[model samples]
Target: MTEISRRALVQRLVASTAFVSGASPLSAAPAPNRSPPPPAPPGKFEFDDVVRRARDLAAAPFEPVAPPLPDALNKLDFDAWRDLRFRPDKAFPIGDSFQLQLFHLGHLYRRPVTINTIRDGIPTPIPYSANLFDYGRTKLDKPLPVNLGFAGFRLHYPLNAPKVFDEVIAFLGASYFRVLGRDQRYGMSARALAVNAGTEAEEFPFFREFWIETPESGADRATVYALLDGDSTTGAFRFDIYPGVDTAIEASVTLFPRKPGVKFGLAPLTSMFFIGENDHRFSSDFRPELHDSDGLLMHSGTGEWIWRPLRNPPKPEVSSFLDKDIRGFGLLQRDRDFDHYQDLDLAYEMRPSYFVEPRENWGEGRVDLVELPTGHETSDNIVATFQPKDSPEPNKPFNYGYRLIASLNPAKLSPNGRTLNTYQTTAAALGSPEPINPGSRRFIIDFVGDDLRYYFSDPQLVEVVPSTSQGKIVRSFIVPNPHTKGFRAAIDVQLEPGQSTDLRAFLRSGSRALTETWTFPWRAS
Candidate 1:
């Protein structure tokens, strides 16, 4: 298999049956004489209990400690780890709708997390045992500790087909979690919190424990609770996940700061963008475009929408859009055509775009989008978050909530014209001479929306308005593209050597705005 296909099979867990719970096929019989496990001590449980624990943890000096795992297990390679599968019969079966599977501790994922099943408001912890897994290889004949714990877990449900028991969502590797809608494959991921992100001393607070509530028969939803701990912040998170057309997760978080908040990101969405329509200086591949996400879309509080195309620049880049009472923002994979990405495996078109809708006004914050340089498609190079202007004092209370919708289309989030795609060519292509100034570049930004109506009949009436912050607008115009049925806004700009420019454009006619704002940052190579 190709590298990406192998990675998708491994990372996406498409063939995770061995990982789910059995050294053999899921239909294989369990060890004879093994009976169902009895739930641990049950006690009154509620989301507030997690909040109390986090609050208490923040009151004391932060403890950055984790129990060490067995050296043999720690030294296992990826292939060896993949061979160790959880026995499916050992999963905590919640009717026919949900099944829970645990991840084994290994080299990369060393930190152990607590897992529990909530019954009637009481939580019963699930202990670890070597018999629960099938050790296919590596000569692991020695027995492991009873409290060996687990790395993370995955939830299974019949999303696409009945009796298929497709994996729906997973909480694994730090505070990361991802969900797959009906036909969408895994792409971008979401996090609980980001402390001092993008700075020299940035900290990644992890979810130390998870509490998964029991699912009812034939239920289409489940809830999970998490406790986040780190050097800078301790927080409690509750996620109510509903799987459907656009798998939506309603998130409620409460954070307690251990130190004064310097900088942080809320509802951060992380993705990869190795190469796309905007930048292609580094690509030598067969596919026309390759990325988990292509652009960042935002809906401002003032009822304005904006689209910023993503890029893999020579150096790391970050941009912020300041606003009060922010509405929503996310990294989106808008291009769904398979022709755009011709790879038969790792279907990029099946990736879903996540749009986070704030349940209430998130007062005084800037949507920060950070793009880092990456060499391959495997590494995530993009992060977008809502950075609140004012952070809560140390040891004080802070709370926020939002709804994350995993969909291909972010409808109703913005009603204005949408940016279809962005491409760049030399200024000479736009009627300039060869070797036309080294500082000159032309851009073709296609925007389509309700505003494009009637513009075809009176094409010359509509205009493309463009402006730059640190350069001269060499030329600008708007023309109709019969192929896209949308107006293409073309602009040429001249920049000095080593100069960077912020360009903005939108469709307009007679003192009225015709399209949502399109923003791009350009640096002369």
Candidate 2:
């Protein structure tokens, strides 16, 4: 069956289950789970214990389990779910610096995730109580079970405003977790691990349980441990989260593959790229651009900076940048103009960009980007991950660690110039009677930096170095854009039919480079 038909069938099944459970018609039933048996007893509950549990679970055949959601809780619709609020007084106080708020199971989140709080080296499971939540207008059945568990949890701290505790981190569906920096709204999501993404057989590993280590008074950070389970792999993860101006989370992951030759994506990120300045296919709105991230920024092993604009293509597109012992990569929302996205409620402009910095050398691999076609901005269509050239062998353990930073401001790892904006325009000016050029396309790129400004200020001080692999560079020029106080590089390229071009451009003053190299792929219409 087609993907659309399969999706429709799943939707119908979810609706039917919700209806039978007396939930709202629009609510999706809990995901059909292929559950594993309870883990065997270990001498000690350590990181290895988590991996052992995952491996033992994967050894047995998968069994599906239906989450037990009470009728009253399951009946909540969107509005009703929003109305259910956790009591502030009951929040899990992790010292005076941080607190944890539990989310109730309803609406989109129907399955409960196990949560345990660690204090003074002892682990205690957080019990669920209906009284902990206040159902504003939605009446619920009395005396809910204390063992009902929780859908997810959020971490709150006074990062932005001193008078208020802002939500800085959240753990929701599967192995996904989103974090925010000071004065930044959440955007992209990071996973503990990804297996075989973009391949014919893709598997999503989920964190079934979490252990949050309580911090002491005056402590500025905390640590969270999770156990990940999948059909072919099992893993353990530890994240040390520090929320501030440049919120950073240091993660250490150890994976144990059940079978050999399993492709693993270390430090995977999921985001959305609808319509942007670079590529505008369906332009019915006037906002100019709408996206969580505008481009993929990578710091190569040779200290070269590379920037590739994100695209919402007509079809699923997967691009890979081969590298050896890469330094870092991230999905960056470089466009910070509020006028670019006119949506006040969502505050797309203030959304944080995530950067993944490797702690150790990861041998030859590629930073892969998977762009899935999306009709609307609601669905996340962009996925970026690290694909190691070598596959992990069975029964052996593989380990990797990295630091992830979520910040409202763009990363400043390099002092070199940065891409301010990228836009596409007609090759020929309006009202011109020039002959139409089908293969000719014009692209405008803006570079901003103090060094670039000083170098370009002098007359005849800078030159544009542009190259294309599969296309002829018809024209190229560099000029100062007065509006942005930056230099703008315009280039027009003519491609052959059914051909694509990989173009690269950078500004240089004499022998000195002034900007981080910008690269893009142009396809013939």
Error of 2 at 308 (Å): 0.8
Per-model TM-score versus the true fold = 0.89, 0.87
For candidate 2, write residues 292-388 as lDDT tens digits.
Answer: 8888888887877888889887666677788887888889998888888988788889888998888788888888877777777777877888888
Question: What range of 10 consecutive residues in model 1 has the weakest lDDT sum?
Answer: 20-29
* Local distance difference test, candidate 2: 0.76
Error of 2 at 125 (Å): 0.4
Q: List the residue pairs that clash in candidate 1.
A: 21-86, 21-87, 21-88, 22-86, 22-87
